[model samples]
Target: MGRVKHNMVKSLGKRTSSSVSPTDGSKKRSTLQMDLEVLECPICFETLTKPIFQCDDGHLACSSCCPKLSNKCPTCAFPIGHIRCRAMESVLGSISIPCPNAKFGCTDNVSYGLESTHVKECIFSRCSCPALDCDYTGSYRNVCKHYYSYISSRSTPLHHYAFLLYKASSTVRMNISDKIKIHVDYTNELLFVVQCFRESYSVCVTVSCIAPSSAKVGKFSYQLSYTVDGDTMTYESPDMKRILKVSFQTPLEKFMLIPHSSLRGDLLETKLTIKKVIQV
Candidate 1:
């Protein structure tokens, strides 16, 4: 989505694609900041994206929601089409605010003109891992750190369980003692990613079905087993979706946090399997 600022500004709710650059935050939010909420698309209530649209009376809507309006503005009930909200866009460009992910160690305070563009590729933006029953969300950097740490803590040997590979060339089979991880893709099949997370001394296992959020996947389950001291500990959960959007099928922190001294040896071996439930 590139910005397309027009030379001729249209109406109040009309939009332009020019550029503005400024950076400020960590201070009190001005009234303008709060008032900016008015610029949100009434349909989705999200800040208007580029090519903002408006009705004859200047009611604003996002480009996405505009086509769905049946050529009528929600606010004024007027026929709406073809008009851009240039005035509102100019106002938005003048505002400088912190990135929404500022709390997550993002030190950027960029101008509103490029806010959406920046956020689309913001490094500070948090994303979820595909692991089932996991709630880990952070930057791509953090996700890498967490993924490697978790997988290495409870990896298995690939030689023991040979499987099909989508692209064997780039997919290197790496081992962490008994743990193994390899990447694969399928043109028309669900891909499973076995993820492990270490909490204190306990280890959590997640069987991630890698796919898109919109994919219609059936419910599934995964199991993990390990013994500690003299007691056997096993954890399992159902309803694993093929894709994880924001949160996990189960909680990560408290699900399987076990004691470090409970393992028979320093290495903790775990097993995982996934099956989609079918309904007749």
Candidate 2:
């Protein structure tokens, strides 16, 4: 079924002379102004693709939905899933539109039927500000302007791609929240948050990234270590979980557990290292 869909889109590409790139010297496809809701699969509310199925009464469903509905039409008790709606498939295959994030500087044109998938990984996807008091939401590219302004005075600067031995200062220890904010350089502006929680016999430390969970922008790895009485304890993470907004809820997993006895004067000290991984 997947191969059929791919081939249908491929064949439609040959039928049109649209240039995805204007500089490629190919003619652009003619624009159409049709109601897109007509192309959605009513059952799933997703854009309809090839293999659209219809009932005798004209009720339509996508291929995946036809089987789930037990080969019966939802609107009418009539049988479905056998007949192919080739006219609808051709309409879906020929339609393409600029990404929804095009307003945020995305230039790629994607098939109208696949726009939902493209939006999930769009680099220009908007992210909510992680600062508790701020309700700002903007594209990752333009958000740093609002981000750095608030955190510059209170956040610690992090040196990327290297290990930095950091000691928790007295001021941080005295803070009621026991949270530390690290701001990476502007070029790769990612906010790292380290939060400490006091348990009955241990101190739990967690690190997280503040970014949109769906944005496919940056990949990072981090290492945290603490040394007590000549013995060292370490925690390394290949990737940090991203959050859309700041929350006070305690992490349920993937936290570094440190014994309260390992503390010197009740201070939490650790060596922190972070490296950004480039994806091909």
The prediction achieving the highest lDDT against the true structure is 2
Clashing pairs in model 2, backbone N/Cα/C closer than 3 A: none
Q: Which stretches of candidate 2 lie over 4 Å from their true place?
A: 1-29, 49-51, 56-58, 63-68, 81-87, 152-183, 194-218, 224-272, 278-280
Candidate 1 residue-wise lDDT, 1-280, digit = tens: 1112221111223332334334553443334214444656667666666778889987778888777888788888887767988887776666666776688767887775466566645655655554443578665445545544554566652222223342221222323232324233322334455544455655455545444322143345655555545576776666553432433233443234546566454355554444445645
Error of 1 at 203 (Å): 32
Work out the TM-score per prediction: 0.42, 0.56
The reply for model 1, stretches above 4 Å from the true place, is: 1-33, 111-120, 127-130, 138-142, 155-280
Give the Cα error of residue 240 in candidate 2, in Å. Answer: 4.5
Return the TM-score for candidate 1, rounded to 2 decimals.
0.42
Question: Model 2 TM-score?
Answer: 0.56
